[model samples]
Target chain A: MTSAPVYLVDDDEAVRSAFSLLLGTYGISIETFGDPAAFLARAPKLKPGVLVLDLRMPAITGLQLHERLAAIGCDWPTIICTGHGDVHACRRAFKAGVVDFLTKPIDEQVLVEALQQACAALDMRAERAEAAHLVAQLTEREREVLDMVGRGWSTREIAESLHLSPRTVDTHRANIAQKLGTTSVAEFARLALIGKAP
Target chain B: MIAAPSFEPASPRMPRRLAFLRSSAALAGGWLLLVAAFGLYAAETHRRALEQEVSESGRALQRAISQRVAQHDAHLTSLSALGLAQAQPSADFDLVARSILRFYPRIVAIDLVRLGPGGGVVSSARAAGGTTADPAAVSAAVKNLAAGRAVYGADARPGHYRLMKRMNDTMAVSLDIDGRGLVEEDELPGWARLDLSSAEGPLLEIGARQAVPPFAARTVEFAAPIASETQPLRLSLHRTVTLSQLVPPLPLALFAALSLAALVLVRSLLAHRREAALARAAAEAASRREALRQHETKLAHALRVNSMGEMASGIAHELTQPLTALLSQSQAGRRIAATGGLAGSPVDEVLAANVLQAKRAADILVRLRAYVGKSAGEAGMHDLRTSVSDIAALSRIDLGRRGIALDLDLPEAPVAARVDPVEIEQVIHNLIRNAADAVEETGRGDGRVVVTLTRAAEGAVITVGDNGAGIPPDILPRLFEPFFSGKPEGMGLGLSLCESIVERFDGGISAENGPSGGALFTVRLPAAGAIDEAKEAVQ
Candidate 1:
């Protein structure tokens, strides 16, 4: 797995400096922007990264920056950090797809944990894409058998539900397992759920 | 957080109108009182002067009539002397009688008679062209004469009289007189009547008898003995008169009336002048108050700026980003330093960031100072709770030093209002300072000031309560009166300025003692958004 840098966009230079220093000790590469416009100017070249955002700032707020980033196809996992957060700010943060809403002065452990979760989510996205690619190779009949198996149905129950012979259902499930490269029903269910997700 | 309080200016029209009515009524009432008093005095003086004049005139008339009657008696006495010398009816005796009658016309008749044994008049001598005495009256007179005494008699006609005198031991004389000849009827004033009589009966009147009017009349009576020894006949005169005829003439009465009228006019003019002066004074006072109010507003704005300048560092807390960043950076630097520190760029970068945040905070202060320095800017709608909290932050340190704890109770809903933010803050700051001072003065066990903001139909209500010495009863009514102070060092402008500010915003302020023994001040202001809502409804 490739390491990705954590991007920090905040008007407060000291907050960016302190968080960068702290995360550096945790072995994370960090990049800082004093303004959202400056970050947006370089957004096209950004790789997948966890973004630590300040809710309140002059020119453009963190939530507004998030929307601008998303408009430019740069939807990074965002963590919001601010001195205060009212109901309106909290509602706006969630609406902007913030990974975590953190109020400053931020706790070191919590920041670490939230970053770890975001990294885990990125890893999961990579795995889901890989799984989706593998599942795309299955035939229609094989895919039906995989869906039933993902529902925890027996091969015979899958045959009855699809009005097919049990032996034929068994053959379709084997072929799905071959194409998906996962004989485990749990793995199959995850791939099927990912495919089913909107 | 210091809550924003409502500030509505008071309208002076109602109080001024009431004051005008009261003063006008008082002025008019005083004018009427003076008129009544003067009228009574004038009337009393007129009555006294008229009474005196009438009384004097009546006495003078009576005296004149009496003197003339006495003169007739003197003539009668000379005739009696002549009768005593002559013995019988002779030409000489008749000559004496005629001569007396010619000299005194009031003596209508004179006669000499000799008494018989039965006291009858046996012989007599008479004067012509004179009133005749009755023979019966002469007989009666003789009877009395025979007893060695003179007698007087009066007939039914007014001013008619008879007198009998003993000339000697065997002789007597009779005289008949008309009293009317003593006085001319025209001599009396129009209002007066005079009567002359003897003890015997009614004699005569100079004028027709007059009926007394309902009001008072002046009367004089006089009596004089007609003859000395021969006859004890009395001459009496009475005079009755009314004051109108006898009052001092028309010019004098008119002068008195005119003087009274002039006095009333002068009094009314003076009253009008005094009322106008009072009204002018009231107007000047109101004008002065308005000027003072403008001055207070300017001073309040200046004071808010001064306070903000003084609390520069504290206000910097409002820029949380810089402070939070500085605090976190410094903490991170210390943490890094504890681990033997970082190499060149990392350590240098943290220090640079700290400097940058400090500079940013300074910039924030500059911006805030500029904001606070403005005076009489256009009013803007502001959140009530937030404004109040900002004021509370400014006063927190001062209260802390005095060991007074300020607790704010703000409603969840936003109380929006329109006002100059700095001016409103100054009003709140002053109120909080007053609360702190009161708490310090009381020196109670615990010092606490609770500030509460509530929304009402009329507007927003802000109440500040202190657990300290309550407002003194005598000073409570004048709590917001300019220049009225209970404290030795107090300028007493704080609450007054607050009231002026609040009233300017179409609000009201009041002070009272809380039920639990503390001072309470309430400020009410019209809600800003409510007006827009009403306008929208109307539209």
Candidate 2:
């Protein structure tokens, strides 16, 4: 898999640059913005990546930016950094779906680990999207066969439940495999769950 | 800010002395007048008693003399009757005449004379050492026989008189009287003089007259005619009332002592009242001073708490940025070194950046320590314009973060005052922060704060105002009261501390809603010269 992109936003220039350089050494490429405004203007065009944002900033806070991104249908995982972190803000950030909350003079390893976790979450989202797109291509009967198969039903049971011949259920399963590119039952179940996710 | 009440110590001595002197003079004058009145009354009473005594004594003496002279007339009439019964001179008549003379010693002599030429050979009688009547007495007797009435002849001798009576126009009887023997020596007082006189002249005098000092004695006299048919006599008594008699020493001494005691009592009462008044005044002054001292102590404590709070928040924000940078750079350097990338990588640059950040954080700590070093600083003459501008510059950092614009309008000329620079800074900082908070509360996009400094008549005038929702009328009056807060996280000592610090240097601070709908705070400081003058005035 390609390395996921990372973006860091902080109001202080030195803190921004320091975080960028530190993350770069850990093989994490980062784009830095001086303020939340600059990061927000570029948020729309950004590919799915991990967002590392300062909790406190002029014009917008990290949590507010996270909400704004979610409003625009950009569901990137976020890691929040702050000069002074409080429990309420941390709790609020988590409630807003932020991956982590960290305070300044932050432990570099902890930040890197949080960023890795965010990157993994982003990769999982991308895979889920691809799986949902592949599931959309399946014919209606094939989708029903795949659903029954994901539910651990045999081909005869599927045929009996649908009032079709077992031979017809087998053909529908073969078509689902060709469209979804996964013949394994676990892959089938994963794609089935992805297609059903809200 | 509330001005400290001034108290002048009560000066009780001068007025108290004056009051004491006034009362003392009144008491003395009153006492003297009272004593003089008593003396006059006593002296008048003594004079009246003396006059009464003299009158009574003089009347008694007149009665005694009158009775003695009437007895002589009886004796002569009896002797003439004896002569008429015998028709010639007889021993019995002589014996009777002698008895009469002996019984009444005032009659020194007795004689019986014929009215014709034979009257020269008339019978005469005398007491033990008495002498015969003189030729004048015989002539007077003969004259008395012709008139048929008895009369006393005057000036027979000193204190002596003669009385004669007619016996049927043939003969007359005569008696020589001793006037001095009529009155007893004990009948008159030692201070009195008595005199008896006939129609002719003074017949007798008794009781030696005493010499009285002029203007020092009161004289009382009693005079009356003696009640005697045969003799025309007047009796007079003279008495001199001396000073010692008129004003008795015992009562006068008692009165003087009472007056003196009253004067002392009144003077002591006045002194006691003065002392009580002085003590009360002193106590009041002491209480006032103590109250003022307690107020000052409370104000100082509040100032300390407020400054410390501001310092804590300022240190937190100021140190965080550099610390964040330093930690990041050091961790980055450590990571590069562990991977054996230090020699040729950006490790040197990272280490240098870490040092710089550490120094930046240290510099911030030093500034905060200096700020918190002195809780109470010495005041000095400082230009208000510079202080206002400096505070404005400092507040802009925090205000800008909240998107509040802070502006300064400082005069070119210096506005100077005697003030602790740190405390003044705290005042300006509190005002600016409050203004920013007010502006932010409104959440206006164009929130602005303006701090203006200008020279004023008193000294310097600093006005900090914000274009935001003005303060509520109910809260405005209590804005500077300690422990009154409008914000959730406020300790409520900011504005109160500002007032205390400003007023400490003889300056004033006030808050009001601006005309254009914002909260405005004005601080006025007395000029350095004015403060010095005030100090001199106090001294």
Among the numbered candidates, top lDDT falls to 2
lDDT of model 1 at position B434? 86
- Per prediction, the TM-score for chain B is 0.47, 0.52
Model 1 per-residue lDDT tens digits across residues B213-259: 76544654554544334334444444554554344346445655666
TM-score evaluated only on chain B, model 2: 0.52
Supply the TM-score of chain A against the true chain A for every candidate structure: 0.83, 0.89
Alpha carbon lDDT of residue B420, candidate 2? Answer: 77
Model 1's TM-score against the true structure: 0.39
lDDT of 1: 0.67
Q: Which ten residues in a row have the lowest lDDT in candidate 1 chain B?
A: B4-13
Q: Candidate 2: where are CA atoms >4 Å away?
A: A1-198, B1-42, B73-87, B116-118, B134-148, B211-218, B244-280, B298-539
TM-score to true structure, per model: 0.39, 0.42
Q: Report, for every candidate in turn, its global Cα lDDT versus the true structure.
A: 0.67, 0.76
True contacts kept of 1: 0.23
Candidate 1: tens digits of C-alpha lDDT, residues A100-124: 8876555566778888887777777
